[model samples]
Target: LSYVDGFDITRHWGNKSSYHSANDFDMTRHWGHLSPYHPADSFGIQDIGIPSNCEVSQVHILHRHGQRFPTTAFNDGGNTQRFAYKESARWWASGFFDNSDGGSSSTSYDLLVIPEDGTENNTLVAHDSCRNSDDDIIRCFEDTTQGVFTNNYLKTVLARLSNYLDPKFNLTIMDVYAMQTICPYEVAYQGSSDFCRLFTEQEWIDFDYALSLRFYGNRSFGNPTGRVHDIGYVQELLARLQNQYIYVGNISVNSTLDNNPTTFPLGQPFYLDMTHDNIMVGVLSALGLNYFKGSPTGLPYNITHAPNPPENF
Candidate 1:
């Protein structure tokens, strides 16, 4: 049987006045670049070509976490630096600064946009620890990735700050990626962040240029687009995923699914796991998601064919 398209489903079941298909949220454009993890307008059916007599009795699902910044801290990767008041003033005086912020020199400054000090020590610390023992299910898997402040998340923090911050002073974001990701939301939401207040209507037009560079410029280390190309990590996760349902003894066992569902109905009613995009891509690869796999000319180990953020499946 052919799968029902999302648009068709929406037309049939969604409110007629405001129905929107998942296609409306295309994940290939500027905002769509935040795909895979981006919210879907509605869930659609996938064509499996099952026999007419067959019926689906059980469903399994795996999903990535919500919007977040690159795992490697900006400072660690040299992608961002702490805001320096003296340096900014000097740059502006020497004409070395770009007026991405709309405010002119004649405009009196009330609020200052600066970065927190001691950013050098912003290292990737262990979020949790896991032992090697096979008996402990809770301690078997743990996420080691670290996340920095970027993307739509910035808007969330900035919105909160606007309530207490003064409107007189202009704000500037030193982190390019953070600014790029936050730019869209700032334009839509008036009370976004103090940093957003710096951009005038005219400057907002040219702001896309800066964001493009931050997104498409550097290719090494997954710059512009934060992606993981390490094959070792991908392979590791794929191995674990493939073995996730294979039940073995307590020593070195990896299966999570109960072999006998009739005997253990409540054993695995619902399974939820949260992970980073890098690992999620690996799982997708193991599951044989062809579309996610990059072109033959491009290497998967280089993130040419990997799952990006906000992908819903």
Candidate 2:
């Protein structure tokens, strides 16, 4: 956490590279994907200066869940079969997995069994203590019928997690993508883990496009032509949020829980909630924070350019 101003040209003299820069604070939003977290992207204690006269009162916060593999909606195979096909073809051309007798066909991921040595699988192990020799890793890339955590997603995630821990840590996936997204950042600073590093930059961009299709595609109402803001999805999210609280004036107040035993916001000084990015955006839209009847030429929803540094509430 400690850093010097410049490159600290003392690497030969025993100083490690701990340089700091003002650019560290400039934040970029990657929509819960595998993006590095800049120190400046988040608030630091010192950055939230102490008031000279006023005392701190209450605080409320909401944040998106961690970066994860694409959601089940995209992992369902049909949506991502094309990407998998392309990536596998590239791997086949590169002879990346040729060290093993993983079969001759790159498209048949089921037949591809990774070799123990001389292959990148040596660096990849899952949480189940199952090394990469099995078809788990390739299953993620090749299997078109797999569900979110069924085939290889959870195992790959855990194996990647086991790399940094005491090796006995039973890292589990909670049937969600946020945890999947969040865990890799722990080892991201180390710049290791091939499972997390499997995609090229352009590949990631393509992967993002697939994700956009999952969220904003024409499968749902109000999504014809791949509209960015799906009115149906937005309404659904608002209805779900309404069951818990109602937006009153400038803030959201909890709905009366006459029959429920849960405590209200009576004694709590701080409240924190973690949810999907779509829910957060939907909440903002419900509040009419930046309401828009954008024209067809306007920026589409999921495909549009996001605000630089992303706007803060």
Top model by lDDT, which number? 2
What's each prediction's clash count? 10, 7
Cα TM-score of candidate 1? 0.32
Candidate 2 per-residue lDDT over residues 1-313, each given as its tens digit: 1121223222221123221223331111332334433343444345657668986565544444232233334432222222332333334433544534434544533222222222221111111122331244433322221232122334454465567778666556433243433334333334323233332232233333333333322211113222222222333234333443323211112223211224222234443433344444434444344323233432233322222332232
Score every model by TM-score. 0.32, 0.32
lDDT of 1 by residue, 237-265 (tens): 33444533234322112223223333213
Please state the error at residue 189 of candidate 1 in Å.
12
Candidate 2's displacement at residue 242, Å, is 16
